[model samples]
Target chain A: MSVELVDVAGLDLEAEADRVSARIDDFFTSLLQPPGDSRDQLYAAMRHAAIGGGKRLRPLLTLAAARLFGIDEDQALRIAAAIEAIHVYSLIHDDLPSMDDDDLRRGKPTVHKAFSEATAVLAGDSLHALAFEILAHEATHRDPHVRSELVLELSRASGPNGMAGGQMMDLAAEGQPLDLDAVTRLQQLKTGALIEYAVEAPCIVTRLARDARTPYRGYARNIGLAFQITDDLIDFAGDEAAAGKRTGKDAGKGKATFVSLVGPDRARQQARVLVEQAIDHLSDHGEEADMLRAIARFAIERDR
Target chain B: MSVELVDVAGLDLEAEADRVSARIDDFFTSLLQPPGDSRDQLYAAMRHAAIGGGKRLRPLLTLAAARLFGIDEDQALRIAAAIEAIHVYSLIHDDLPSMDDDDLRRGKPTVHKAFSEATAVLAGDSLHALAFEILAHEATHRDPHVRSELVLELSRASGPNGMAGGQMMDLAAEGQPLDLDAVTRLQQLKTGALIEYAVEAPCIVTRLARDARTPYRGYARNIGLAFQITDDLIDFAGDEAAAGKRTGKDAGKGKATFVSLVGPDRARQQARVLVEQAIDHLSDHGEEADMLRAIARFAIERDR
Candidate 1:
């Protein structure tokens, strides 16, 4: 039986997720076709890393948010693809021997393992470069200012002050006793920033004034925290086989997650609270925003 | 007895170079000041990698190119800083254990050595993100189109089909024999793309018609090739003390290079020829283009 949130119970995200994944795959295929040159290996590695697998949660969030503003599907697709590209690049780098050293990603051998370490490094860097390239492409928006804003918004979300900063903190905090507030801050930066960007990017495309983004930002922020909390909950008590990659890694490494500071039950309870609060942020909108409300309720459903 | 290109004789680049370096240092310091947070380590790592080192060749190239178009100095400086940030980020990643695995860079411990490998990786990724962020920042250019173009050009220069692809070739070519054509193609991507962008980017800022960029593109391509030839020549015969990093790695690794294919004398001669051709591309410009001419001549002067 499929679990569903009460208010968003009728929302069928699977079909939408499949569509987003298919669109992203098509984008990658078009962008990364074989070069018939030595660099073809680089493209191959990029394809293996990005082409398939993983729930299209982040991109779906982007699309869902775009639906709120009735953004052009093609423009929304680029934004979604750019965000997913960044997420994929991060995964490639995170799996390198110098970092998390995971042998598997998306249930396949990581890029470094399948290709080589040097190739993996370059592949990750290339994809990181591709994110900005995609956003800056003229086709992303008719207005150059919108494209520029997308680049700026995305760069800040992924850069030193956001995801990277949070990652640094995560590395430093290992084996250290961190309080709930500290952990929350770390989570906010590590994963919340990108999720927030995914939700707010539609506003950029729609040319909605910056001040009007408050409710949307609030909705994204709450869901981002809720998503991370759910991820931590899964890592704490979830099964290894079901999770694909290793589960219980947090407890194994003695990392301080939401579940470590508070019991799993309290953590799950807090995630539900966050989801409810997230849905409340969209009260100003009607049926057009139902997908966003659905996304908030289903944020914790990211099993992958 | 300093070496100087004969055609561009008496051009004093030292004073200008110093100014550019100081400006870049100041920009980095302003952007990456101590955050009074755990991310201070990341900021410190970024500062270490970017501040007070190298010839600032990429940024200086950007400034020199901008001079041809009479772009604003502050705008030129942002363009310069953005290019330098990409260069610095590449260097940081190039020194990673999974990539070039170098212990030293610019006579200091590589970021991975001074900081953790994880920190170095994150710092590199952050700086890569920063390049686009800087370019997309409104202060970089008043026109959004210019800023967007800057992001596109810079990202394309560094992405999979450019520097990263070339790097992949270099990795694959190690221990295998290669000829002049293969090495040229590799170096063009590995080092040539960014240099080309450095010189061509000014045209993007000025909104020069795409066709109008042909001469500048030719100039950049010639100097870019010349620059790599000079680099291989230096790597063949230069000193570690003067270079501030390990030298002779190409020979040590049996990697094919211009020197390997053409011998040192021929490589130097070829580099000089390229410099002259690079200068020839600016036949349309007058005294205002003197600095660009000087930079082309000095493209082979990057000892560190």
Candidate 2:
């Protein structure tokens, strides 16, 4: 039984996703290589890694969260772009031979596999630095303190204690018997932290009214965890063609995924519970929360 | 003949280097993982790549410049540490299989060779991000505009048109004939950019009186270029043991170098001229410029 948001029209969802995607595309285009630069190869590698595929879920969450707080979309776009940059950088490095060693990501050859490993590594490093640079540049992000906070949040989420740390845990536990709790903790840091940062950065930047910030944090945390759970579920049941990735690879690797620990049926239930908790926090905002609610449910139920 | 600055006593140079080194050690220590964190492996890789060996040349120049302008050493320490972090990150990524493919650095196994490639990549990426994060957090850099400038300068130095671009050029030009102009441009982007940033940042951060900032920029550019040329000379003449790297590797790789484009004797002559030009920029300043003068000469004249 897949859950879907009944009130929001399907066309609106597509439009919102497209809108977020366009904004992100434009952001990368603008900040990524100015004219007359001789470093075309490096810029090409960066663009190759950033553009072409993957749902702009993190940036969309950032925009939606800001919209719920009544912040202007223009004001939120840089922060959104910064989140996606960091996310893309992680994916690039994660695909390297020394890491997950995956040949394909989002239906394309992974960065290191497609380009040379040196370019891929440098591309990831440059993109990671670019995220903060884009955020810190006054022309892009005007408020110094807000820019500072954005850098801090992105760094914390991307660094060892966050996504990188989660990756290390995932690497160490590849063939180990991790319990459900260990799996959850790993996912929370690996995937959840960045998602949480995406949802909360705009609020932190805008200095949302204190009362509004508190509940939104709760809303973000739940959805972030829910997103990871659904991601794992998809990996478990997803078709290789539709998913654009090799399915069931996790089990072959002896990875301790949520489904591996608790079984798929229970994992699905936990995901739904998380979606419910995520939506509950936005009850006070009514229609303003509708898109977000739809997104949370959609994230779990989508085939790819 | 090797140029020397008689004004800067050896004791003073050692004292400043020691102070900067200690501060860097403290910064790395504070960044150590909390017990039970999943990032212990990644953190260890980063520490291993960063701690001990190598001349802290970039950071020393930063400290020396700040000192010349009467900025307190305490105020410059964070920025100095930040520069070293950037330099270390570049080295780790450069030595990876996809880039330089070197097996060793500073007489020890390269980070990727010592640890897993994934850890090396992540550690490099983390250190790059950490440099910006540390700079953004500088309490001393309270002016938003100045802080923004610092971020931009460092980013430009670290990004495509800077170190990354240089590495790409090196890759593209390997075993190919590169003219003197192309080689100089590449070195400027690769090595000179960071050295330039190292010198300019402290002055920018301190909001040095306009007159001082102008001369500092000129001095930095000359010293930066001179430093790279000197590096080529050392690679041509220095011993493997003294350089902490295999001597004559560049010649073996058929890589273009200043010494390759110009004869070794001519390269040495050019380096001396640049160093003299670098020192001349500080003529208006008194004894404070002595250390920088000594450093410029040392960069070119050192055996290693």
All candidates: TM-score: 0.94, 0.92
Across B1-304, the per-residue lDDT of candidate 1 in tens digits comes to 1354444443557778888999999999998887898888999999999999998878888888888888898988988888888889889988987778999988999999999888998999999999899999999998999999999988999998788888888888878968999988888888889988988889998999999999999898898888788887777767543556554778778798888788889988998999888888998988777777777777776563
**In candidate 2, which residue pairs clash?**
A118-B98
| Cα error, candidate 2, residue A279 (Å) | 1.2
Those runs of model 1 whose alpha carbons end farther than 4 Å from true positions after fitting are A1-11, A239-247, A301-304, B1-11, B239-247, B300-304
DockQ of each: 0.84, 0.54
* Residue A271 CA displacement from its true place in model 1, Å: 1.0
User: What value of lDDT does candidate 2 attain over all alpha carbons?
Assistant: 0.78
Summarize candidate 1's per-residue lDDT along A1-304 as a digit string, tens digits: 1344443444456667788899989998898897888888989999999998788788999998888888888889988999999999988988888788899987899999999988888999999999999999988998999999999999999998788888888888877858999998998888889989998899988888999998889898999888888888777656544655564777666678888789888998999999888888888887777777767767776564
Q: Please tell me which predicted candidate would have the highest DockQ against the true structure.
A: 1
Q: What fraction of the reference structure's interface contacts does model 2 contain?
A: 0.50
lDDT of 2 by residue, B69-143 (tens): 687776577788778889999999888887888898989999888888878887887788678767777564766
TM-scores for chain A, candidates in order? 0.93, 0.91
Model 2: CA > 4 A from native: A1-9, A33-38, A209-212, A239-247, B1-8, B138-145, B209-212, B238-247
